[model samples]
Target: MTTGRGLRGTAAVVGIGNPRYHKRGTSEDSALALILKAILAACEDAGADPRGIDGFVSYANDLNEGLAVGAALGVREVRWSTMVWGGGGGGVAAAVNAAAAAVATGQAECVAVYRGITEADDGRQSYGKGHFPPLLTAHGIVTPAQICALRTQRMLEADGVPRSAMEALTAVSYLHAQSNPDAAAFGKPLDPEVYADSRWIAEPLRLYDCSRENDGAGALLVVPAERARDFAQPPAYVLSGVQGAGPDWSESLENDAAYTSAGFHPALVNRMWDGAGIKAGEVDVVQVYENFTGPAVASLIDVGLCPPGVAAGEFMTVDNLRAPGGGLPINTSGGNIADGFVHGIGLAVEAVRQIRGSSPNQVAGADVSLLLGGPMAPLVSATIFGSAATR
Candidate 1:
């Protein structure tokens, strides 16, 4: 959507880092401190000097300014900086897209795309209190769970996607989290009985269906693809980074055509796959943003990974979504639902790890990895990462 040769194999993620994750309000470090630590760690991972960082990109209304962070890190210069304008994790992939664009276009040689969250910080606002049209508020659709529930309900009833699909998706993330010590839900295994027994936050959206808020920061260092192999870590090439909303998607609750769909349009999905020169069946793993399980299910269908109708029930089984042997291993880092959510930046980092074959739940021969940002938001994004073989 940015319009050019596209990001396919133009830029590469050389390094990724994150601080120790904590539950909201429990982090000992400030947001700024966490972000700085993450960036420094990324630089170390890449075997690059911190002073080499010349650009910064972030999303979700991040408060850390580029020039300020540059100064803190003693960077040689701040050449470029930008933030994706939107709410929620929808812009996560967009932020990485911007960073890759900067590197590809030579606007800056090394860009660090990062996000930090200190939900307990003073003056922090509840996500549910976001400004909405009176039409939505008057109907008591204030919380995100209530808003997304409507779309999930429609998909189940109208599209005939079984509720078990949502259950399986939720179970998969928790299942993966059990193996990831960094996951907030680590050590807490989820079974179908436990998921079914959980209370509903909104009708059709159970407690396990939602993402957990955590305090942490995550970052990825992007450099030109030619410079990728110089790093210590295996580079994850930027195959494609796509972001946009569907036609007339601004109407939110009133848009009938886009109502039950994830924010990804058919044309957008086509662009991403085309730009990457791959298809849904070619992706070895996916790290779909699990802001809620239902929208994530819709995202999988919208991207052509799963069928649009009752076939999703059979395709989205726990065995089919798990790592190693699953047809489509997803959320290998546990996803936002179980992994620490620093506004979905962690998902991007996990995508890189999958490409590097360093993931705890590594998918064998994972040459192509996909990362889908938050669904059902005003704007959504999806990115594709690949190993050197794909380039």
Candidate 2:
């Protein structure tokens, strides 16, 4: 198999639509109606027709299939539809990558990639409940907070990272969110005092460290770069994208040698950079999947934004990342912790929005934006978007 580097520039994300996200059961529409609304929003952003779309891609364990979506959207014909394989945001970027490959390889055109979740209407998914499919209930390692807390504790002990580091990381997300009226954390500013006093959900992981379980849908419209201008918004070319794990794929929590691994940060750097044909330093904006605080910081390091062991001191400070131009602006749209999670699709839309110069918290001169999925699941992926002028 080729490196798939050729996938670069073959397609572009022309439109991204994220309607208001809400807490569970508050949404006015059913799950399917919410999805259709999101698709229509994306089409409006692209100035393209939903009926013109020939393919679709989605994650969240295929909660809704493409054919049904196509039928609902009144598409002319869906020649193809593909599903990315993880149950949560871990497969978000990969779904976009898959759509790019589909368009590039002539499998389809005008592909709609999306994620529609009704956690609010129903209830929080597996993460909220103590459920880990791989590890039986006997281990007591069921929820995401529990698993990530283990990794964070290990890093603090093994790497000498300060407790303040994690707090700052958690704090910066809310700081950015405060500037975004679209964020769930918009009005609620997270100060050091609140962060310090917040109750601990898991050891080394405080209440603020966890992500919100919101009910919403997010979608993006993708088409060949050459034809993007024929549609609505300025095209953010799909410069490069990839999705993979560190080393172990099927390793269990108790038995794996790399069990303590907090996803694939240090590992995915070289590959993501090399595949994208751009150095990490060239990235103007970053939209990290902040499912929890620790993984987000580790993601910055793993993706090469900062060096190992220096993320906390060098990058986690509020003064550094709060606003654009001080340091790299991450999760400019508030991310999962603050933005409300629809798996990882919301983060991807924010990355595209940054490239379009339309994000709520805009990053200055952002020609290249890196969007990461949940690598902390240890099975993750990412995509890099570039402005139209970028090669």
Candidate 3:
């Protein structure tokens, strides 16, 4: 057996990049331009040669096609390329895992995991084209907000969590965004009164609880850990990663266990922690995807960050999620709710920034960072990253 968290300690992220984030149509019809801009910025950040990139990986719904993007980047040759199948933000962590696996196996030396997104003036980004059917699109549960709201309802009824749990996570994102100039929610002020009266998108879930859509792209470059030191910046070592779904993971919407429960958390967390040789308490920072605040709260509990079930509401406090004095700082780049939601992979860029000591909302001496994407059914992924000198 190759043994012990097979993806751990092999790959390291050396660079991350994002173009100037724009609100929806402010950068519409320019997805291609944004993708190219981020790629060039990532290469520059890594001090890498544009022609030397050998692999590319992305989430399933991504607008940036790898082969085409590589050609545009002036790549010498694309030795390998892959996509994490399934729509929604759940695949972001898996995309990183895919790149790490490629580097660890010698399939490719330099790999990039990216997502490019651009939308119209109203600020809505589509997850996929045409409903992938067998879905509950027929019954008013047509979009992610409604579907996830059902899951949150289950948690509220059976899991004992209150609405405050979701509210705290939402508030934390906006609070951090106020400090991040590149974020779309910057200075917009999602205050308590605004959050309280934000009007429900789905029953208990309010409009403010949903992630904001913006037009932008972000990328991260991965390489073998042994070679990471040669890069221009401090390496964020990939400690471990894994992707999986629950028993009936495909069963979303009606009567499915995942619809009423936290998706893929139990299946992913145990294996990921065992492989990484670390636990939640050891993690100093996190970047949980913010597709919806409800799932994000359930995710915190399911991922071992807090005890399972309802008590997590007390743990996800705004004070605890803020930087510096907090026990665990999360979404310091504002996350999907406050930053731009580029299918959640932009959280990876923020994760790297935290490890590199360059984050505008830096958490002092953070050695271990956890990045999670999903809470989407039948698909969720998470990865642990650390400083080169990290334990």
Alpha-carbon local distance difference test for all models: 0.87, 0.77, 0.81
Model 2: runs farther than 4 Å from truth? 1-5, 120-122, 127-131, 134-136, 254-256, 265-268
Report the C-alpha lDDT of model 3 over 1-391, residue by residue, as the tens digit.
1255487788999978887677766785477678778878998999999788899998847766789889988899998799888667878989999999999989999998888777752235477443345556656566778778878888888877878778888888888888999988888878799889888889778998888777888889999888898889999988889787766775443556555555655656888887778877899899998788888877777787855555776787889888867888889988999988888877999888889999878999988989888875447888888886763
What TM-score does candidate 1 reach?
A: 0.96
Cα-based TM-score, every candidate: 0.96, 0.93, 0.94
Question: In candidate 2, how many Å is residue 41 off?
Answer: 0.3
- 223: Cα error in model 3, Å: 0.7
What's the best-to-worst order under lDDT?
1, 3, 2
Q: Global lDDT for candidate 3? A: 0.81
Model 1 misplacement above 4 A: 1-4, 122-131, 251-253
How would you encode candidate 1's per-residue C-alpha lDDT over 117-225 as one tens digit per residue?
A: 8876623433333536788889887777787899999999999999989888888888899888888888988877888889989999999998888889999999999
Model 3 — TM-score against the truth? 0.94
lDDT of 2: 0.77
> Looking at model 2, which ten-residue stretch has the lowest summed lDDT?
126-135
